[model samples]
Target: MALKDEKVTLAHGGGGKAMRDLIEEVFTSVFRPDGMEDQARLQAAALADPGARLAFTTDGFVVDPLEFPGGDIGTLAVCGTVNDLAVGGARPLWLSAGFIIEEGLDLALLRRVVASMAAEAEKAGVRIVTGDTKVVGRGMADKLFITTSGIGVIPPGRDLQAANIRPGDVAIVNGVLGDHGAAIMAARGEMALSAEIASDCQGLGHLMEAVLAVAPGLRAARDATRGGVAAVLNEMAAAAGVAIEIDEAALPLRAEVRGLCEILGLDPLYLANEGTLVLFVPEHEVAAALAAMRATEAGQGAVAIGRVVPGEAGRVSMRSAFGGLRIVDMLVGEQLPRIC
Candidate 1:
């Protein structure tokens, strides 16, 4: 193809000379700045020891209407990766981005998303050192998809996991719940009443840093993403072979989100969240943990919502607003399947 008449072809996904040509010509050349490629390898080589334990995680992004009211796919992808590292008690250092672009996606739009991702990386003090790209036939794939892989190093003398949970532990949330899911529904014109609900898609590392600084012995922390706070709690209960009792009255629910959930017949407890976290702390240290969380942007709405109990493991029960009790279960199929 001539310089002025280039077209994407199936060869782009082959990982061969033609594939490299497409990636070099269409992707890196368009989105990356100088010295951007292969930074992961370069940084990994410089680690204190190449054999050190590394925290690795990967996720795929395919939210519809990529650009939403509060955020787009690029920002969510970056925040998701960083939040995972943060909650795992690791210092995020590097990332690898993989893109699958539909054949006819606007080059300018792709550029904008890539730039937003770069900005997020800079904010989190992480670098996108390596990546791959493939373009499919226009009708064969969605507009664009992003898969981000992150690597971080855990600090010494601090350990956290589901198995650490036990009876007499308190459960806390970083902030009010269900905002992100509500925002996405509103942005998509699925909600009847329109308020300026925004997706809380932000990196929670800074907030986690604040809490860990004060309580290095923090038991367990998880971002309330797809399955929300309710789903995460159930997972923890099962993992630790314990049961959890949550006070519905104590669960923070913004009036707007709550109202929408009721109208739509949706349970806010199992809704989605992008920037919120559910953490388990020792009963005695709940106050300090809540205080530290409230001090950070990601956790200003933090609150103690429940406690751990021993009984039937893997189950979560909630006190109703009417003083009744009910079960909170995992999302059956998909609440927002590709909203990640």
Candidate 2:
């Protein structure tokens, strides 16, 4: 191994032998890109299709604690960018990762994060084609921060968008919500809480592919990330000029997450999620969509939670278990910071 030091130093970012060693041993070796070029030379058959379109998305991961229950910053970075493209009905193909490491941080930890990114990219059927690494003073950054940009191909005839949603469209979610947020909170230990909840951090590219395969008329999908499912529902309703009504009894939530929210006087609807996604399909294809999603590992808990209705435009409401209706408005402020 060329990297003899146990911890990173400023020399690693000086574009010297130390930098080369760090890049070779820690990142490039695991990712194995085509070359060490300043940019990736890319080619794909999907791009050659006449009406196919390109999809690109970038995201930065600064989740506190660096490592959490179910995933770490690396897992979050790759999956986050991949899901961003997947929700658009794109087949994620490539990713570019950039790392900012704090001086004096353990090299072993960095290696582990890089390895996790490699494993996740492979599982999602994407390649980490290019990346950059930099080291900052100890106090200049957290242990590490990662930014990822992804590229994918949206096949011809696939025009999924929130604006395509309409009344009678069925709303479905892949799995339980609020687990990621609750897991982060418990990991922080500031609240003096304890729970066995694991962050629901996983890639959804395969799940989306499966759903689209059976339900070709899938209207739209949104990964419920920062603002959980409520934010996504509101966005879809606003884009489609429609109303969304969800059944409270039909929502999928873990008991621990529900308990945590109730204890903290928080609404689980606003909690963040990493792998969860909300999708809308026409009434006729709802069963097929649900079956297709449930058949996938990432969406085994898929279920119908709501439906679009003819009512006030941009309105979202929840039919409580008590059978009363109340508006589920857009999140007003941050529910959990640095959550993903």
Candidate 3:
């Protein structure tokens, strides 16, 4: 029962004294210096925010290893949920975290994750308003898993959706593709290879604001997470009933990432990305959108890679570097699971 020998146990989730002690000594100690409460309360005026619409999103993180090159699971939780709201033209404000910790897990590891989450929230200017914790048997779950839900304010007349995509709309990526996936894969150490790669995990709320400020007519925006840009484009093409054509040579892929994908027989376009985003902007606004994206740290490498066209609805094609056309289909199965 002492801190020195402490490890997560079912009693820590029993809603009893053990639960209180665990939460107080660990989560609250990092997440809230003030105190812990059953629920987080905010002023009505704070939520109103000039009558802006609310964007709500929730995501789960079960990434293996829990930590990777550029970030850890804690940072991923905050960035992933915040990016969800950002892509919808929202300014993220608050988040709720839930942890499913496995018995026998090291308390120190849990503290490290909690600390990372707290730090990332501060950087993104969001609050960890409320949270819950549960402990399962050692074999019932992985070492730890986190679920984060967030809410944000969307300005008036800033609606964004894939259905708004039209012919001539351009597809743009914020940065190099597949860094997150490649980093995670390399971290796993299963391939017995080495490459200098890091997960491209970071908040995009500021980048979205900059682009929206200049190109309010942006049709759609999405973080290239689980399925990467290929999935995003396929979904958007289907939603907008248009075909998407991308130039293979235009994709900004890192040499390390490309090499990793090549050795593993994976397509960088299909690999996951944590910080990258895909934006669809009208032809007239493409230049301004790129300019706005390049102005922000998160979007400095932004480039227009493709365009929408009239064809079979829901089709995504790429012009191969070898001068042939190929379909970029939705991944039949996960290429790298638990990369996020």
Candidate 4:
């Protein structure tokens, strides 16, 4: 039998009876998945559906403190994987989780993390189909690290890619940025000041569905995670060999976040966000897309922030409020490591 009140130990990862007991009592109990096979098998008929394409993505999470404002590592892992598929215009379906844990960690903490993952999976309408777990010596591994992989289905003709970006295309963001990064920084207690920021960690599958239903011609979409919107915009420009110009006056930023960034000498554009998305659509379809995004609770703060333009290839520039221009560059090194 699994030890209900004891801490995790190396034996739990020995692939013996202790491992089986732990798996059944913790992960299996919470997930209660329909099947428990060596590999998940999908019916051929499902894959043969007309216009269906599969999207697969994986992410790793090692946020310090395990838990934070608005979310924990568990929530981060599931949402990060789901957003990766959503941005590709895919409907998330199944997920696999892997855990690397430090021995002597509290069993209650593991239960909490697994339960959080299950909750997020349900919210995104995805199932945790399979997973593996390992336990290492206390100092050899962090408290807990999780990696999640997901598969999603893309409908016919819903091809979205940076290569499709065109001049005059509109740039829009679903909501505010830098909340997740700011929250994590504050949670670490490394800085002296505090703010009312909370990590914007949540699933974006439903929001993506709403937008796609209204504006099927969306050229491309990217989740501004690591390196924030700056990185994504730079990549889009480089990939499409076009120039992107954003307006400083139109950026969606919270007052607390702005103040926090200034105080810390960090650029909000370089900070990370979990629940935000950057979208590209032809100018003609911008209105329809904005309307659709605003209809969802997660997208109520949507706004058009800029436009694609013709300039030096692979360049991103921002028009300042004072009518000046500044280049938005990629981050050189890690601003906040283990942030995801």
Choose the strongest candidate by lDDT.
Answer: 2
Candidate 2, which segments miss by more than 4 Å at Cα?
none
**Residue-level error in angstroms, candidate 4, position 64:** 1.2
Q: Candidate 2: how many backbone clashes?
A: 0
Candidate 3, residue 269: lDDT: 90
Estimate the TM-score of every prediction: 0.89, 0.99, 0.95, 0.97
lDDT of 1 by residue, 187-212 (tens): 77754668678888888888888888
Q: Which of the two, 1 or 3, has more lDDT?
A: 3
Model 3: pairs clashing at backbone N, Cα or C within 3 Å: none
* Better-scoring candidate (lDDT), 3 or 4: 4
Question: Judged by lDDT against the true structure, how good is candidate 2?
Answer: 0.95
The lDDT per prediction is 0.81, 0.95, 0.89, 0.90
Instruction: Tell me the lDDT of model 4 at 72.
Output: 93
Compared with the true structure, what per-residue lDDT tens digits does model 4 show for residues 178-268?
9999999988888776686889998899989988888878999999999999999999989988999999999999999999999889999
Order of candidates by TM-score, top first? 2, 4, 3, 1
Candidate 3's residue-wise lDDT over 1-340, tens digit each? Answer: 3344357878888988888888887887777733555788754354556667888999999998798899999999999999999999988989999999999888878888899999999988888888999899978998999999999888877879999998999999999999999999999999897897989999999999899888989998999998888998898898989999999999999999988888889999988999999999998998998998898889999999999977889999999999999999998989998876
Reference-based TM-score, model 1: 0.89
Candidate 1 structure lDDT: 0.81
lDDT of 2 at 76: 97
> Which run of 10 residues does model 1 get worst, by summed lDDT?
1-10
Q: Candidate 3 or 4, higher TM-score?
A: 4
Alpha-carbon runs more than 4 Å astray in model 4:
44-46
